[model samples]
Target: MRTALDVHISEVGPRDGLQSVKATMPTADKCRWIDALAAAGLREIEVGSFVPAKLLPQMADVAAVVRHALTLTVSHPGLRVMALVPNRRGAWAALTAGVHKLTLPVSASEAHSLANVRKTSAQMVEELRSVVALRNEVAPGVPVEVGLSTAFGCTLQGAVAEDDVIRLALACVEAGVDEVGLSDTTGMAHPAQVRRLFTRLRAELGSHAGAAHMHNTRGLGLANCLAAFDAGVRSFDSSLGGLGGCPYAPGASGNVVTEDLVFMFEAMGVSTGIDLQQLFAAREPLKAGLPGEPVYGMTPEAGLPRGWRA
Candidate 1:
């Protein structure tokens, strides 16, 4: 929320990263990692998801973790605690946990939608409307957004049409969501596609256009992000150490790396309001929590440029 920051980065490591991994970080470790991230100046973080404990045991303690994260707002004022909800039940739980924001994943690819959420694309939009209604009744102040997953392409169905992505976004808007972000869930996005789709997204949705959730699956994460920026996107979703991938999307891997992303913008003289040194230090808790887990980042490996300051 800093006025000086040119772009908004929402850290999704806790939810997206942890869920895709084999280990369940202890609740205390999760809190510590989150604290480190907040200290590093990440204003918004998707702390966890609301799903059946049997389905994702890693997120079984999500409610408790959300409460712990809420306490951080005292020190990190303006920090927005966010959660991912797959359905109306999940939305209700997230609202009850006092989350500042709720993001629902509605896949643009019908095959991906059915596989991930057990619902068709149309059914998922209806689900979103129900979630929005619940939010209005109980937590009207909370913002509800949709991450239109597989907007770029899908491994299951392959090459999702652009029209589907735009249609689903407008449908979510009509369902009362505040914003709809395009997600490259399969990491199949290229710079030109990213530019064209995001430009069309901004034109159609206007102020309702949201974050660019690019994956580094094909090594185009940074380039796609730069393209999104060129197309007028100001918000992005990344993970510390590039730790996330879709469980249902086969062959998809790695969320955009936070360290590399902040470094990229800062090196270009774009203010991210995030200190690079502290951001690197934040990776310590992550390593401790998920030991031996590969956390990728060019900036962390090479160190900052000589005499560099952010």
Candidate 2:
């Protein structure tokens, strides 16, 4: 299948990727990695989270990391600096840091939401109401993104109903989200499921939604990404060297590999505007950031094959 579409890949290595690993990337090194990725032409990058330092030591300096990322001069110039906020407090911290975008992780699976974040679906939406209220009051210009995690299935619960995910997505948007996106938190998403859910998501949210965040834990990340793109999703959430996963979910692989997703799109005659070579060039600083961290990705390990072009 072929279509004329442009895809924007967002790197989540600094936040999602780093948080998965036990070792913390030095604050400075993390900025360098983010800079390298930006140089590679990635438009949006989720720098880190605004969660408590004691709970997530790796992200103890997330605010500092986001500030550093915002300082970089990327190709887009006004890069999208994204951070995850677990609650209203985190949302306040993220806004104070001047982040370009703030995303909240709202699990669609009821059981997963309660177990992972200790908040039921309704409670999470309520938190969004407060986060949205704060953003409207202090930074009305800043956009809030609700990443509907476990939209396809859950680790604790077997299968996540598509209806349930869609309902929560609608609720989040109604609560005051500028946009909404779906995440395959457990990597149980199939390409068909990706297409179906994202198609429904767009139908519900209209022109107010974005990318698909897929995990490679089950090796379907890239395939699922293609499905979402086919379903009208342009932006995507990926991590450098595939170095991320939910700290709570064990089998979920890191975000889909950035290089791999970019390669797939670029190879299929789709323009991502991201240079494959420069994208891989980012690996050095990424490795330098968190030494001993196991960065995952097929493109990084195999290197771009002969005659590849972006």
Q: How badly does each model clash, as a count of residue pairs?
A: 0, 3
lDDT of 1 by residue, 150-237 (tens): 9999999999999879988999999999999999999999999999999999999999999999999999999999999999999999
Q: lDDT by residue for model 2 over 1-310, one digit each (tens)?
A: 0123377777888888888888888888888888888888877888999988888999898878877887784445757898999999999999999998899989998888887789999999999999999999999999898889899898888898898888888899889888889999989999998999899989989977766999988889999999999999988988889888887765777778888898888879888878888988899998887777776778777888787653
| Every model: Cα RMSD to truth | 0.8, 2.6
Deviation from native of the Cα of residue 19 in model 1, angstroms: 0.5
Winner by lDDT: 1
Worst 10 residues of 2 by lDDT: 1-10
On TM-score, the candidate that comes out on top is: 1
Report how far residue 154 has shifted in candidate 2, in Å. Answer: 0.5
* Shift of residue 217 alpha carbon in model 2, Å: 1.0
